[model samples]
Target: MCAKKMTYRDALKEAISEAMRNDSRVFLMGEDVARYGGTYAVTKGLAKEFGEDRIRDTPLSESAFTGAGIGAALGGMRPIVEIMTVNFSLLALDQIINNAATIRHMSGGQFRIPLVIRMATGSGKQLAAQHSHSLEVMYAHVPGLKVICPATVEDARGMLQAALDDPNPVIMFEHVSLYNMSDEIEDNTKVDLKSAKIRRSGEDITLITFGGSLHKTLQAAEELAAQNIDCEVLDLRSLRPLDHDAILASIRKTHRAVVIEEGWRSFGVAAEIMALVMEKAFYELDAPIARACGVEVPIPYAKHLEDASVPQVPDIVAKVQEVLNSDV
Candidate 1:
């Protein structure tokens, strides 16, 4: 297979471009997405290539534009709605959870919302508390939506197409920290929106995570390798319909697990995974399942404080070692 190296931003742009080229129904609408080339520049040059009608720039109102996207999808258009950041997405919560997510079920299958909402999420750029937290758990908690966090270049490039093919709504989270991440991906790379991928295989412990935290977890695994602790890194690509089979399989093999998340510890995604393990794979555990999550507070603005608030490489390594050395 032919491979090419590109930044995560470029991969996402390629996905959007391919989708638009293949389907006339596909169009993108969001703030600064057209003329300003997007806040992150992912949509740069796309406006010119696709024309203003296809690549649209909207008002500052998230709710207004998001509702417009939903209407477009219901009217047989594959509308991609870009909420500049996860924080701004809150304004569109009613439109998203109420309209886009529920119209299909409310209409008793008569209506299907083929909406794709893309948002830049997570911290690392020092954008401060308002612009920074990982709010994926809120979206994942909803039953009618498909929530996905693409952690790799292949997924960043391929998941958009998969989402567009689905009959319902899909929410795609692109971690702000990963925009510059570059890697070699196959030209034929295919991505499924439902599977969890095992990036690194091991038998000692499973370091379960997704999105931005994936790289940090991988680095932690590397550091742990020197101490003879083999860590398996499982990327929970799809947060909504989590691949329980893959998660359980990893835990059953390792017998010890440490779930990692950038969200706050209380009632976070890690907690849900931990509960699942306890119920289905309780006997497989050699030690209590552990979690390394962000501190329960607004994300700080200062670089050092922000770094301290979330789970870092050292934190993950220490948590893994703690689980390994536990007598319980």
Candidate 2:
């Protein structure tokens, strides 16, 4: 496999093109996916290569197009549906929850929805409340669906193929801020979706996060290292079926845990992860688990306010410090 530095956007495009080339059953459907080349340009020029039939574009009807994607998947095709953003995905919630997620159980295991839904998520770019939000938790709450957040360039290139191969529906959340982020990745690397990955190894404390919050958590780890606090960073790649083994193992080693998320703390993904740690690894903890999360308010349009609403690098560092300082 060839290794080269590339932006997250290019990596996603390569993943989609590769998937389509390898599987004749794979096709993409969404608003502006073809002529407009996708909202983030991840599918740009794919239409020229795959043609309109495979790279079909629809009007501004998320529910209709998403339902069509579900239908296509049920009809023996692997369909990749793109909802413009997480905010817009609400329009297609019925199709996703009622149909795509429940088809197997409802049909008594007679049908499977091998569909992959990709959407831009997280708060950044000053897009205001409507366009910016981290709602991956809502999707993860569902029992039958699989949710994955590709926090790195390697994952951005590999997770799509893995998602397509799954028998159940998979929701892929791509942080908008990461589209321009660049990293070195092998051309043909395949990422497994079953487990969380430890981004850094340490013995003092464990920092757990995913999606846009991962980089910030890693930054916090770096700063903590300078302060003589060795921190381990775990990227929770798959949210629905969380890597419980990896989480417990890391917490067992470090004994101190800090969970971070771009979503609000109450009932957020962080809360769920914290619960898991508490349930399974409570005896191993040296202190109470800490959490850094988004503010419980509508995301503001102003740049500074937007930055304040979500978890930042400084917030993560401060939380980790607080956890370390707390006495059992």
Candidate 3:
């Protein structure tokens, strides 16, 4: 069982390349995906390898290209649409929500969109409010879309293939900060599009998070470990169709839980997870479930202000401690 060391960006590129090589039906279309080799350079050398037809580039219009992707998918092609960022995805909300997400149901199963939309999400690198956003929750709220946030190199390398195999549309959120994260992935890695993974196991408080917040939560767990406070870190890999059984299993063991997310506090993914714990695992709790989330404001352009707006290691550690110290 040899492991290959690579950055998260490289892992993603491998996934796309493998899919295109294996399936003639699979192709990628988006702004600068081919010529510019992706905004983050995840698709750097793909165009040269796969050629322009398979790695086609589109105009700057998110709605137009996204709709074109939907049309291609409907025509029995597996189209991978790469939006520049989550903030820009708002322009394609109509095509995503109204069309791609509802075609199967609206047509009574006559049409299925085997479309995969990838977008960079989260606030980092001083991108400001317009370019930085944690909008996965918006797509997860829809019924027909499968939303996934892969927080590890393994998941990043494997989830794209799973998404392409599905009969419905899938949206992948690649955190803007994770592109350069380097780690070893198992040589024979297999990733599912569903299921939450417990990155670290502990009997004390459970730390639940996904996407960019995952490393911060795991780091918080490590810091808490040194202070004699054990923390279980749960990565909610699949946002839609959340693995409730896995979540409740961890909650049952840990008793106290703290959900974390980079999205705003109000009606965010953390809120949904906390509410689920209350509903299904209420009697298993030793204290009230808590959450740490982003401040409800447009992300700032300044470095310090931007960092303060999102959850960090210290923020997660404090939240875990607060939940652990509860007298309830």
Candidate 4:
């Protein structure tokens, strides 16, 4: 397949456009998503292409629009609800958890909420506490919701279609920092939102991460490679139905592991991955599993403090080295 270079933002827009064109049932509703061209400009020309009816614009009521999306899905329409950012998604938590996520189970499998919710998550752009957050862990904690984070351009372009095809509610988290990042993507590329993908294969240590932290982990792996330490980079594309086999396989081969997450260390995604490793791959380890996570602090507006709060390339590199040097 021929590959073309594109930004993550463009990839996402292409996915939504393709889905909307192929499926008449799929429609988008959110604040500034239509005439305003979206808060992040991902839906810039969508309104014109799909028309205002399909690319609808809603008021600043997250709870209302999100709830409407659930109702629409129940009415046999596939609605793509954009919540602007993860911080604003808190307003629609009730609609998401109580209704969209629980409908299938509560209705005895009769009613399935085939809804897809897209939101920008994580911190890096100095958006402060209100606009920036890595709250996918909270969504992942929900039983009925399937949470996915597309860290690369290819995944960003392909995951939305898979989410739309799902019978259950799927939440797609796009890292705020990766929208402008560009990469080569095949013209006919499609990705499954299921298993963990090994971004880089290696033997010495494993660097596990997803979403915004994937790039940082890859960079750290490159640095470790220069130091004669081969590091495998694992991208957990699907967070909820985590690929346990893929994670375990990586740990079994590498022996040393470092889990990285943009969310806070305590009770975050990184912690969950570490626990999984300890539970299933305990005997296959050479050293204790380490984690590089965001400091337990509200992301600051200042660049320096915000940078200090989240996991970075240096942090991943340091954690990998620490795990490698530790006694088994």
For residues 147-258, write the lDDT of model 3, one tens digit per residue. Answer: 9999999999888778878989999999999999999988658889889999999998889999999998999999999999988999999999899999999999989999
Q: Which portions of model 1 miss their true places by more than 4 Å? A: none
Return the top candidate by TM-score.
1
- Model 3 segments more than 4 A misplaced: none
TM-score of 2: 0.98
Q: Report lDDT (Cα) of residue 214, candidate 1.
A: 98
lDDT by residue (tens digit), candidate 1, 52-103? 9999999899999999999998899999999999999999999999998899
lDDT of 4 by residue, 1-328 (tens): 8999999999999889988989899999999999999988999999999999999999899999999999999999999999999999999989999999898999899999999999999898889999998999999999999999999999998888788889899999999989999999998677887889999999998889999999888988998889999999999999999999999999999888999998988999888988998899899999999999999989999999999999888888888878888956
Worst 10 residues of 3 by lDDT: 319-328
lDDT score, candidate 1: 0.95
Q: How accurate is candidate 4 locally (lDDT)?
A: 0.92
Clashing pairs in 4: none
For each of the candidates, the C-alpha root-mean-square deviation to the true structure, in angstroms, is 0.7, 0.9, 0.9, 0.9
**TM-score, cand. 3:** 0.98
Clashes by residue pair, model 2: none
Candidate 4: stretches off by over 4 Å: none
